[model samples]
Target: MSIKSVPLPDIGNFKDLPVIEVLVAAGDTVEAEQSLITLESDKATMEIPAPFAGTIQKVLLKVGDTVNVGDLIVEMSTQDNEATQKPAESAPAPAAAPTPPPVVDAPARSTTAEPASPPIPPTPPSTAAPVNAPTLGASAHASPSVRAFARTLGVDLSQIAGSGPKGRIQKSDVTAFVKQALTAPAHSAPATGGSIPPLPTIDFSQFGAIETIPLSRIQKRSGKHLSTCWLNIPHVTQFDETDITELEAFRQSLKARADKMGVKLTPLVFILKAVARALADFPRFNAALDASGENLILKKYIHIGVAVDTPNGLVVPVVQNVDQKGIFALAADLAALSARARDGKLTPEDMSGGCFSISSLGGIGGTQFTPIVNGPEVAILGVSRSKMSPVWNGSAFEPRLMLPLALSYDHRVIDGAEGARFITALSRSLADLRELIV
Candidate 1:
C-alpha cells in the first residue's frame, strides 16, 4: 500500500472557498467518488469527492477553513496503483490573472476655487491610549455566501450562535437570528427595518405538560425559505372551480390500461397537463424575475414541481418537460419522484429548475386553500378536493364534478387580469382535455 496526499479539485474559478462540512475522519474507510468535504461559495455549495477508495490516515482540513485549488485536504493509504501513480491528478491548474478595468480620466478640477487655509500641527501620540475597536461580524466564522446573506438582511453574524460544525455560521443561523430578534420583546434589541411590536413570550409548560421536539432538517430549511418568500413576494390568489366531469371520466376509463402499464392514473396528472397547456398560452406564468428583479426570464421549457407531504416534511420534486409527456408518462414520473421523496432518496437535481409548482391536497380534505407563491417561479396552483355540484347547462341543471383551484401569483410579475385569464385558461383545459391537445 502507498500513502497519498489528496488536494482540492478543479472546482471552477472559486478561490479561498470556506469548508462548511467535513464528512470523513481519520482511519475511516471511504469508497471511490465518496464525498469528503463540502465547500461553499457565494453562488452555490459543492462537495469534494475522493478519487479512489482508501483508508484515511489524516484529515488536513476542518470546517471554517478557507481553501483553494491544489490545497492538501487529506492523506490516505490506498492499494490501487492508479491512485499512487496520479496522486496530484485532482489538483487544479493555476488560475489566470484577472483583467484590469480600463482606466478613465478624472474630470477637470475647478480652476476658480477659494484659497487654501493654513494647516494645523499634528498632536504627539499618547503611550497609554491605544484601544482596540470592536468590529461587528468580524469575529464570526462563516462562509462568504452566509456573510453576504447576513448583510442583505442587515443581521450581525457575531450575535448568532452557529449550529454548523465547529461553530461556523450558516445562512440558516442568520435567518433564525433575525426571526428571534423580530419576535423578541419590544424593550429588547430592535430588528433591522422592522416596526411590528414583538409578541410576548410565555411559558407554555405552566398551563400544561409540553414536550420539546426539535424540527427536522427539511422543516428548518423549508421554513426559512418559505418565510423569505412570504416576506418578499406580494401574493395575489385567484380562486376558481373547474368542472372536471369529463376529465374524471376519461381518467377512470384509462384506469385498467394504466394498471397494465404499471402506473396509477390520478387526477393530478390531468391537472399537470392542463397547467402545462396554460403555461404555454400564458408565457409569463412560466417565467421568473432575474436577480436584479428588473428583467423577466421566459423559459421555453416547462418543468413543474409537485409538493409531496412526507413524514419528515413537505418536499417538492420537479418533473421535467411536462409539456412533452403524456398522462401515463407523467403519472409514472410522479409515482417515482414521490416514492423517492418519501424515502428521502431525492438528489438536489431532482428538486431544482422548476418553472411552476403544484400543491395538491386532494387526497387529504380541503375545500379551497391558498398556497404561497414559490419565489423565482412567479406562480403556484393549489388543488383541493373535488365534489359533485349542481351546474346549470343551457336548458337544465346537471350534476358535475367540480374541482376547486387556487392560483397564487407574484403581483410584481403578473397583473390581476393576467392571473384571472391564466387560471381561466387552465380551468377550460381541465374542463375539456381536448383543449390540451390544441
Candidate 2:
C-alpha cells in the first residue's frame, strides 16, 4: 500500500484561502497533479495540486472551509495499476455508416480514410442513486429565490441543461439555459404553469411629494453597513485637484500591453496603485476601526478597494495586498472585478473588508464629487473626469488632458491637514508617474 499526501499550494491571495469546492471525492481516480480542490482567495480562484499519482482515498475538507499553507488537503493511494482497477482504454471505431443502396437523388461518396484513434467506451452511470417520482406542474425541491430567478428569465430547467452543484439549478445556470432554449430547435413544453410573476404596482399616497425607489438586496445591505460606519467613525474631508499630464501620457504609452492583459490602465487604477504605495510610508492611513470601544483597530495587510458603479448600486471591491501586485496584474484584476460588479454577480464576500477606497468618475471627465468612505476604511479617493484643458506652458496656454482628483478621509482617525498632505503626495505620485512602473 503506497500512501501519497496532497499538500496545499501557496495560493497568491489570502482572501481566496477559503475552500469553495473540493473536486475529487474518496474512491475517485485523479491523474498526478490534477486539480484536487478549488480555493478562492482575494476574489481570485485557484486550484490545489494533486501531490502524486493516486486514487483519492479521502477528502479532508469541505466547501466554505478555510485552509493555510502546508495544510494537508487530502490523502491518496498511489498503488501500481495492477493493484487497482485496470485503466480504461479508448474503444475501437465503429464501421462507417454504410451508404444506403444508391438512390437516384443520393449524393456522391468520397474514398477518404477516417482517423485511426480507438473509439471510447460508454461510461457506467453512478451505482448508488435514488429515483424520485417526477412532479407535474413544477419542482417542489427548488427554493423560492431560485424559482423566482428561473421565472424572471422564462427558463424551464426540465428542458434546459443544469450546470450547478449536484445538478441543482443555479441562477447563472438558469439564465444560460434560458438563452440556449431561446435559440434551440422546436421546443418541448416545460411543466405547465411556468410564468413570470408580475411586478407590484406602486402606491404613492403613503409618502410626501418625494419618494425614492427602495434599494436592491446589495444596495440595502451596503447602505446599512456604511451608515453604521458613518455614525461611529469621525470623518474629515479634504479636496484637491491635480494636473496629471505626465500620468495621462504614461498610461497611453502602456495601452497595448494593458489591453492584452485585460487591464484598464485608468487614472483610477493608477490612483489606487499610488495610494497603496503611499500607505507603505504612512501606516496611519492603512488601518481598520475598533468599534468594540476599547482600542483602535489596525491591519497588517494593505488592501485597497476600488469602488465600482453597477446597475444594482455602488460596490467597493478590495484588491488585497495592492503593494504586492504589479500595475498590470492589478489592472487586470480591476477589469475582472468591474465585470463582476456590472453583472450584479458579486457575492457578499466581494464587498467586505478594505483598508482604503478609491472612487472615480474621471473616466467620463466630470468635475468633482465627494466619495463616501466605504465603512471600516479610513479614506476614499474620488477621481474626477480627465479632459484636454488649457494649462500654462511658459506663459502660453497649451491644451492638454488633466485629471482632477478629490481626496476624502475619515476625520476621526486622520487629521484634515494630514488628509490634504496625503492627497498632495498622491498628486505628486501621479504627476511623477515614473515611480509607478518601477
What TM-score does candidate 1 get on C-alpha atoms?
Answer: 0.70
How would you encode candidate 1's per-residue C-alpha lDDT over 55-129 as one tens digit per residue? 999999877677878899999998856544343454321111100101111111122323222222121112111
Model 1 CA deviation exceeding 4 Å by range = 5-24, 31-51, 63-73, 81-197
Task: Put down candidate 2 lDDT per residue, 149-244, tens digits, no spaces.
Answer: 544544443443346444555555555554444544543333212221234557776665865787654454455445445544566667776777
**Candidate 2: worst-modelled 10 consecutive residues by lDDT:** 98-107
Judging by TM-score against the true structure, name the best candidate. Answer: 1
Candidate 1: give the clashing pairs.
Answer: none
- Model 1 is weakest, by summed lDDT over 10 consecutive residues, at 97-106
Query: In each prediction, how many residue pairs overlap at the backbone (N, C-alpha, C within less than 3 A)?
Result: 0, 12
> TM-scores for all candidates?
0.70, 0.52
